[model samples]
Target: MNLYFPASSDKKTVFSAIEKYISDQQFIIVNKDENRPWGGFYVIDEAQAGFFIETWFKNVYDPLPRLQEMVSPKILVVAPGKRLSWQYHHRRSERWKVIGGYAGVVQSFTDDETEIKNYHEGDVIRLQKGERHRLVGLDAWGIIAEIWEHTDSNNPSNEDDIIRLQDDFGR
Candidate 1:
């Protein structure tokens, strides 16, 4: 979720640079077409790999006063060998599609947590409010996250609420 002033809106050149940058690093390119064209790679640290693909993509679009926000929902790429933590979002819920990799998801229930399940490429997953969920990529695949904002903003999260009963990352 990176945005630039596009002093010239030369999408071709700028996007090319983004692709090169991402490939130069290890970030996998999830989507690169007309609908939601993205041109940058976001690398997640240990904590972030155990969290959302990018924990701070909101500001990239929010801070741009000149932009009209062509879209509300954003798509994020979670490269292979990465994982998100057991957490929930107050502002948004996400729908994930494993477009090019294996997705391992774990959900928490009232008394016990569901065993981590795997999804093949093209499988879809929906995350609702208060549904503590975590994910990780396997092999050389990645996940695309479509974010949808909730109607209410009062639902916030705290560190205490994140009860990571088990984590392969050792969190």
Candidate 2:
């Protein structure tokens, strides 16, 4: 947990460091997205992130069931002053927990109107499906624990589900 990324380090370097740390911790990093306009993310195994659900039936309980297909959890690291694209998903909603630093979130239920809010560590924000939303890093690296909740159980959301309306990097 004593990872460090110098201020001058590039995205690739930061991501590589994170990957190495994850590997050293015996956690499987399923994906690494380092080409984003803002910050990047690492999709890790659910168990590594401590994502588990307890189910109960007939006075009995199962404490180790994981909804891997219904949810995708990732850590989003946003660079200082950078923001994600104004986007929405058709098949999933999202819950973001601010885990490190501060962040600004912009959200809109309608395409023409939006609201912005700032959050700090421990704050939680929820974005429903089809809600236009974006995450902005404040003055430092913003780290967020995000969980994608797929609306349809049969089809989980993926990167292709993103519908970007505005992007600073022209993605």
Q: Give me the candidate number with maximum TM-score.
A: 2
In order, the Cα lDDT scores of the candidates are: 0.47, 0.71
Off by over 4 Å in 2: 1-26, 46-68
Evaluated with lDDT, which candidate comes out highest? Answer: 2
> At residue 25, what lDDT does model 1 achieve?
46
User: Which pairs clash in model 1?
Assistant: 49-83, 50-84, 50-85
lDDT of 2: 0.71
lDDT of 1: 0.47
C-alpha TM-scores of all predictions? 0.46, 0.76
- Poorest lDDT segment (10 consecutive residues) of candidate 2: 52-61
Each candidate: RMSD to true structure? Answer: 13.0, 5.4
Error of 2 at 80 (Å): 1.0
Q: 152, model 1: CA deviation in Å?
A: 0.6
Question: Can you write out model 2's per-residue Cα lDDT over 84-103, one digit (the tens) per residue?
Answer: 98899999988787756678
Clashing residue pairs in candidate 2 (N, C-alpha, C atoms within 3 angstroms): none
